[model samples]
Target: MAERRANVWLAAWRRAVLDRLPRNREDAPWLWILAAQAEADLSLARRMAIVEVLRDGRPHPAPDLQAAVEDRLGEGCFGAQVEQTLEADITSLRAWSIRIGCSDTPGVGGYYLKDPIVKAMDKPGYEEHPNPMQAQIYRSMGDARKMRSMFEMFEFALHQVGIGTRLRHPDWDDEQVEAEVRRLVTGIEPTMG
Candidate 1:
């Protein structure tokens, strides 16, 4: 069930990204490249966030791990089913030989990374090819792409809501519609203008 939920969330996210992309693929060859890179970067960010949280070598409860991931990747990045997403990510990490352990003991149990030293050697040929500067730059680009995508999604949602508001209240002017939208978003009534 959790894996299914995570897959659904990921598919929706990918669809959103693809929908916002340019229609003419020939005109913008880099569009697909950028989108693919962004997807890869975001995936890495999610898994790395989990790994970083567990790097302390202590048992972190599910809620703490979830909160830490949200803090690391920004809120809403993991979608609504965050626990499921985290579980999916952990599963992916373990597939990569990450050795994550889980405990169910009440008050003294959670998830933790075992043998952090092995992480460095998990991937062959990359142990001596570390490039901190390049990695930092790539991460920065990924972060920028994520922020831009998020803002684009936000703007699209707001535009749709505005359109709906206008359609429902054809008598309302632009200011009135904007006010209503603001009210819907913030739950605060617009003052008399």
Candidate 2:
């Protein structure tokens, strides 16, 4: 019982950390658990290690990140369907980012990434749509500086927050992404918005 209580407390703490991050308003308790698992399995000191590496200017390689996940969270981190769902979620977000000409940086700044991802995730059809690889490239174009700060902020928000992968891409559309970008950039081409 004590052990279970401790686990619950830990999870809550993790959630608090992630909540503090910018634009991390969504609840993802699984992220906190994943952080614990990753740390336990890989000897990572904190949950932010994953973001640290990516934000530190290293390539945002999914395979490498997968390896880390596998090492830390074990093989069952996600079943096939869940994995596919996340893939689609990411794919849709990437597609929307491209449709609106957002940076494909490894770490796009809060300036762009937040609204697009949030708004895109709220769109329809993005839940199951798998975009082409070109979408993937455009989604990860942030330079070291942009990504590092973004990652740092994300890490801070998700510090101890549970890790979760949402199955639904509710906000998955280019129109929203484009609109948000236009709103952020001042004096930019009205057509671009």
Candidate 3:
């Protein structure tokens, strides 16, 4: 289970990077997901930070890492969340790189990339948007993630509302209770009856 979670994260990072890379091939839309699932690389923010650190062969501190990620993200928004996110992304990347046979150099100077991970870093041309087709793929990925999150949240909300419905009507059947909750929350009539 732990390994699977690590893999999911690695895939997420790969998708983020692929979204930025130039589109050399006009592959089918969803097929790139398979490619991301197969490769191990840094997450978007960590990859961006690594590139900055490698460019000048200097240790980039946390603040620099945060700014580099936000710059790549454009707008540089998100306030304090960017700091916490950068910290987690760096920590996850360091552990992931080691597990995948690459290691970071020892130092408080900055998190460093070593071995083939360094080679992967060199592949992305960091300063431009992907071609239009690839941009569409990236947008689709983001939309899918958003929809997944919404479904998860919606399920949780429905569960809570079902509990409330049960409280209000002890004699109601489970289906009836849930339908009431669904109707209230979504403002849509239950279609079953």
Error of 3 at 144 (Å): 72
Model 2 RMSD, rounded to 1 decimal: 20.1
Each prediction's RMSD to truth: 19.4, 20.1, 21.4
lDDT tens per residue, model 3, 1-193: 4235445544565567567766743444554654453343325434544454445444556666555554444334324576676656656656666321222454435544443334545456775556898667657777778788779899999889888889989999988887789987897756743
* Model 3 residue pairs with clashes: none
What local distance difference test score does each model get?
A: 0.73, 0.44, 0.57
**TM-score head-to-head 1 vs 2, winner:** 1
lDDT of 3: 0.57
Candidates ranked by lDDT: 1, 3, 2
Looking at candidate 2, the ten consecutive residues that score lowest on lDDT are 160-169
Model 1 Cα lDDT, one tens digit per residue, 1-193? 4334334444554566567766744555565564455455666557866887898787899889888876655666677887888789889999999999998876558999996455555556747676899777657777778789778877776788898999999999999999888766656657774
Q: Compared with the true structure, what per-residue lDDT tens digits does model 2 show for residues 58-118?
A: 3334545445534433443434554463344345545645222223464432112233233
The numbered model that scores best in lDDT is 1
